[model samples]
Target: MNRITLVRRGFVALALVSLVSLALVACGDDDDDDGDSNGGDHSTGSATIGDIAIEGAYARESVTDVAAVYMTIKNSGAADTLLSVSADVGSEAQLHEVVDSSMRQMEGGIPIPENGEVTLKTGGLHVMILGIEGGLKAD
Candidate 1:
């Protein structure tokens, strides 16, 4: 066989193997009914309190005993404040924000404008879950 033809065949074989591997990895446990596609305790859901609605809420896996939570807060009425946060899986939960490239506990809470929304995500604002027992998992 010509060298160019052999090279093409090898590339196709490699591509096929890569695709199969990806498919196998994508097939996760079906028992995860918490609507988290990434699996494990990283759950996703929505909730409403008074005039505010929290959407797309989810937690991240912990490296040690600390994890972070991300979500979007929408206000349907007057402006509101997210004073604090709590989780049963952790000893303490607090609102945190990044300021000038530094992370600190957010004092006075996060403000949500009237009829506006606030997204708490990485590198900005998020919820810190401290003293998480047994750590967190995403599998």
Candidate 2:
């Protein structure tokens, strides 16, 4: 074959290899998303532990073995609620509170009052994961 013909064949072969590689990479990305497609940002509906209804429960970055899981606990019944949280990874998990003292900035305030509600988010009282599995995303 002419030199020009040989060069054309080589270019075609390279393009085919590239296309296959791209396809393989795409398949791998899908494997990472099962019920966790949101990358831990969005939510997976309500998480019911016993009678308590945990609304808007979610975590970010599954790769992080220790994730700060946050949720809104809604007490629907007439009586007040006193509850605690537990994760298999952490040795001890406490129900924290964030308060703004007269001097210091807002931080882990006091323990949740009896039948009181608390929000664990950025710069607020959060679930202290004493230990973690891999990496915990504080964000």
Candidate 3:
């Protein structure tokens, strides 16, 4: 085993570990039958922001550096958009949608049509919290 070969083996091992971590993060709880994945006591209830109401705001306990936030957004007034999401628990918050069994970061904002509602749930549209500080504790 030469020095160059050892270095290449090390790099390969590191890459494999990274890929496994990413795969675990991408695999969400598919058995969440109730849409919400956080189970009981995770909800923050409902909050009204102008004509837009956000309900069932919750996040599942994170096993890694990322967690997804689920909620229901209802717009009773004119059409609007969810430009972004910010939280003190994480360093980066991104809007993502599940496409073909993969989570894709949504560019721009998610549109909220008038008199319509959008549900962010498991295996659907959600807010991904990356670089979670102190991790997400289940309460």
Name the regions of candidate 1 deviating beyond 4 angstroms: 1-43
20-106 per-residue lDDT for model 2 (tens digits): 111111112212211111232243234343333445544444343333444555434333323444454446445444455211222
| lDDT (Cα, tens digit) per residue for candidate 1, span 1-139 | 0010001111221111111111111223323222113334333556565566666666544445776666787778876666666555568768888777677898887877889999987668887777866766544
Clashing pairs in 3: none
TM-score of each: 0.66, 0.45, 0.69
Report the error of model 3 at residue 24, Å: 19
Q: Give the lowest summed-lDDT range of ten residues in model 1.
A: 1-10
Query: Which stretches in model 2 have alpha-carbon errors above 4 Å?
Result: 1-40, 49-51, 62-66, 101-118, 137-139
- Model 2 TM-score on a 0 to 1 scale: 0.45
Alpha carbon lDDT at 98, candidate 1: 78
Give all candidates' CA lDDT scores: 0.55, 0.34, 0.56
Residue 111, model 3: lDDT of 83
Residue lDDT tens for model 3, 1-139: 0010001111221111111112122224535422223344333445564566766665656655777776788879777777666555557767889877777888776888889999988777887777865565553
Better of 1 and 2 by lDDT: 1
Per-residue error for 49 in candidate 1, Å, reads 2.6
Best-to-worst ranking by TM-score: 3, 1, 2
Best by TM-score: 3
**Rank ordering of all candidates by lDDT, starting from the highest:** 3, 1, 2
